[model samples]
Target: MATTTDKVLNRKIVEKARKMKSYAYASDDPEISDFSHPSVINIADTVQVGISTGGSSPAMARKIKIKTESFLKKNISSEDIYQIKLQKFARIEAKQVLSTQLDRKKFLYGVMNDKRVKGLLKEGKYKMAQGRVKKMLRKLT
Candidate 1:
């Protein structure tokens, strides 16, 4: 088997790892991060927001990772996935509705920051948030 170091440093592997890390960082799936730290946090599947110093400062990375985990636990809800999904669906839907790149960008921005959606997300009401997003999309289109 390829050693952990070998796997992480290879360019293609790094790219794949980064994508996997992004998902773990964003999920509430309950898993450990791929860090070499002794005290790894099994925080989204939700911790470490993909902060790497490219082999320069592992300690700093861990510090930031732990801090982020704490911050999320304090401020962000693990189930607040509505915004993430909305962005994805909206991007595809916007292509059908929006005629210009600028219009799509503006529409996405408005959807991202809508307070009602944020409130729904924080409360873990993803279905309600999705419903609101569909309404928003309809209104905008």
Candidate 2:
């Protein structure tokens, strides 16, 4: 019997891959969810937070994650995202008037720092914030 040797079998990359570590975790019940030792917080389907113990206690990581997630969920709302989206659109419109990216960014920075706009956003009044941005944009035009 004769065996054939492949030229690609001598590659260093293949050897390194074979020696790499593998990890897996599973939960017994499908209804119940499990979090990794380094727990994570998922926000608005866009942002995520990860807590790691740095090879310490998993329990501590989980506790910290719960507190942090709860606080963020309480503070951050859809209205905040809506205000951001409104600003993004305003930026596109501002580009035509501002002439340069740097000018647009500077204008946006000033708008964001405006006291009235800040108060409206803090109060979760996205509609008012949008109006404020429109008024500011009108000034630029």
Candidate 3:
């Protein structure tokens, strides 16, 4: 149970361990195992969203992480992840302010459709987009 410098072998070892229901942590060196190590990517997040693809198809999982990193970026460029972040922030802020469930849902869904917000996002003016979104969210608070 020594850590192998070979990445492919490490992945295989991790995969095997995953089948044991001791699934979450993969030890590099069992003798001095440190399962508490932080993974660069959040496996829980991907799993919750079905991104791990687990045994379904790792290649597909890789493609999902590689291809569309930005929200709905399968239709856009990879560099557009920033806009997605802005949108996510806007959504969380809106949710915090809007009280009624229906109103919050509608506002969040329509945020992207608003001409000002959309235009700001399209222009990559994240600051302006955030400001605009905050102003809008304040109205519902």
Candidate 4:
């Protein structure tokens, strides 16, 4: 007879395995879920294999070191970082325009005057153009 805890754990492991098996390996669908739980048997098998192979591997450690070094070497500049942040916030504000009658012109002028948004425009992210049009609606309402 299985204990309550043992039954719960088995159910969790089976559910996770099912979820993992449901998705394609190279899926482009962003909504897919990925979850997997290793069982005790799986852990024992891996340990036995490792013992037979002899000696632990450093491949993962080396890969992480190389990735860290590469990231430090190609770090984004302050201006680029600012531009990315502005683009994100601008997208949020643009979405809000559909729900509110905020003065579009004033809102846009407000955004243009904002240091972050101005930096985004200078970087040539034309998506902000929508915010400008929304500003016009703000004026009419």
Could you arrange the candidates by TM-score from highest to lowest?
1, 2, 3, 4
Candidate lDDT values, in order: 0.63, 0.65, 0.59, 0.43
> How much is the lDDT of residue 70 in candidate 2?
88
Backbone clashes for every candidate come to: 3, 0, 0, 6
Can you give the TM-score per candidate against the true fold?
Answer: 0.53, 0.49, 0.49, 0.29
- Looking at candidate 1, the ten consecutive residues that score lowest on lDDT are 23-32
Candidate 3 lDDT over 67-140, as tens digits, reads 44544334444224545676678768866777777887787766667788777777878788788878877776
Best by TM-score: 1
Residue 132's C-alpha lDDT in candidate 2?
Answer: 88
Query: Which residue pairs collide, candidate 2?
Result: none
| Ordering by lDDT | 2, 1, 3, 4
Quick one: RMSD of model 3?
A: 8.2
lDDT of 1: 0.63
Q: Is candidate 2 or candidate 4 better by lDDT?
A: 2
Instruction: Put down candidate 4 lDDT per residue, 30-86, tens digits, no spaces.
Output: 122242211111121221111111112234434544555445436544444444454
Single out the weakest 10-residue window by summed lDDT for candidate 4: 46-55
Best model number under lDDT:
2
Which is better, 1 or 3, measured by TM-score? 1
Clashing pairs for model 4 are 102-138, 103-138, 104-134, 104-135, 104-138, 105-135
Let me know the TM-score candidate 2 reaches against the reference structure.
0.49
Residue 73 in candidate 3, Cα distance off native in Å: 6.8
